[model samples]
Target: MPLSEHEQRMLEQMERALYAEDPKFATALEGSGLRTYTRRRVYQAVAGIVVGIALLMTGVIVPNVLWVSVVGFLVMLGCTLLAVTGWRKAPKPGEQPVSGSAGGSAHGRNRQRRSMMNRIEERWQRRRDEQGH
Candidate 1:
């Protein structure tokens, strides 16, 4: 559910207070755990894919290791699926996914997400301009 105006204001105030109290701690806490988890999952998938390639090469170089090659191919396929899914599910920078009924229908959610991405891109561009880069 979406927060009321008053609740949103209160939350904003609390966030400002927390930032003011300890900037370092706030910065440390800024990263989302979900993002970290998805990144790690994707990295692990890539590692698995590399291992699979090594196994496949070993199977090919060594004689009578057809089963090893088959296993390696399976591993590669599974890991590729995992990496793709993880990447798709990951939220874009500065995009907070709103869970539950607050997002309404699937189409509405997609529209909202698109708009959010646009906003994030705008902010990134503004920051880059500010930094003269």
Candidate 2:
């Protein structure tokens, strides 16, 4: 069944309220641009990994360059460790549901999110049809 116009308006209003009351939750619900994680961190981590790989390779190839190789290996190791830790610590898309109090496993939350998005998308399609657009 399709939602009536009034229901759609009500839903929009409720959504607005949800956003106003808890922006973090609202961002999670919307699924983008909500994370405070910096793009710079990700870029830096990637750069570090690249530098580390180069160092490790150089260390392995050079003749009579044991210390250089060791230095390169160490650089690579440090960069890799830093990148790995940063990646792990980074926030994921839609890290939480609007109602954070709800108890469920990560998989369950994902299902719930998928269902919510499907409903929202369906409503949007219905509206577009109604408008003859």
Candidate 3:
């Protein structure tokens, strides 16, 4: 079931409270932070790619070592790919969840999660109301 507006507000409030009470734990649960590509990291990646190319060349020149050259080439390709697009920006620990592009898979996933959360929240609200009565 979808959450009513009041219930959504309540949930958001609870989330804020949880974040306030245990920011460290909340951050940890948010998962690893994005790896910012620094100048040093770029340099290292370039060095690794160069080494891989050198190894590949050596393997190609050496008799009976075509496999070594293949491995080196694969390593070079992997490094290049990683350098180009290894990581994306993870959502900041305390920031609101970002909605994905309209009608995307991410939207679907978020919708499913929201509905499940609403079900849980409804149960909680029912118990609260019962206790108050």
Candidate 4:
């Protein structure tokens, strides 16, 4: 979901405050999104694999075209490897927990809430199981 205008303004204010309080820390946190190289790597890998398959097909159908298939296969292999490695290292897309005390407290509360809901669900299930209907 997109942020409301109010939320956007609030976030901007918070960011400004963070910058004012500690410019170094704020800068460190900035621009931490996934690197562009990783996206390119994935795209390259998929294209390589597709081209490789096409080349292999052509080589099989035409005489004296084995080299084309060989080159394609190598390209595909290299691209696949690059993509896999890049994707593995990329950060997941989501709001990361804030650093420091609030983060820990928020995480703890979330866990507690999950546990309570689980217990409630289990109790309801047990009651249903006990009933003949």
lDDT for each candidate structure: 0.81, 0.70, 0.72, 0.75
- Every model's TM-score: 0.47, 0.41, 0.38, 0.49
Ranking by TM-score: 4, 1, 2, 3
Clashes of 3: 0
lDDT string, candidate 2, 11-96, tens digits: 99999999989988786766443243535456776787677677767767887766766776677677677767655655566663
Whose lDDT is greatest here?
Answer: 1
C-alpha root-mean-square deviation, each candidate: 13.4, 13.8, 15.4, 10.1
The C-alpha stretches of model 3 lying farther than 4 A from their native spots are 1-36, 87-133
Question: Which stretches of model 2 miss by more than 4 angstroms?
Answer: 1-17, 20-38, 91-133
Query: What TM-score quantifies how close candidate 2 is to the native fold?
Result: 0.41
**Stretches > 4 Å off in candidate 4:** 32-34, 60-67, 89-133
Give the better candidate number (2 or 3) by TM-score: 2
- Tens-digit lDDT track of model 3 for 1-133: 9999999999889878879999877765554442333343566668879989998998989999998898889888887776664332234454333345536646757998999999999999999999999
Ranking the candidates on lDDT from highest down gives: 1, 4, 3, 2
Tens-digit lDDT string for candidate 4 (21-53): 998777656645554545666788888889888
**True-vs-predicted CA distance for residue 90, candidate 3, Å:** 9.2
Q: Candidate 4 deviates by what RMSD?
A: 10.1
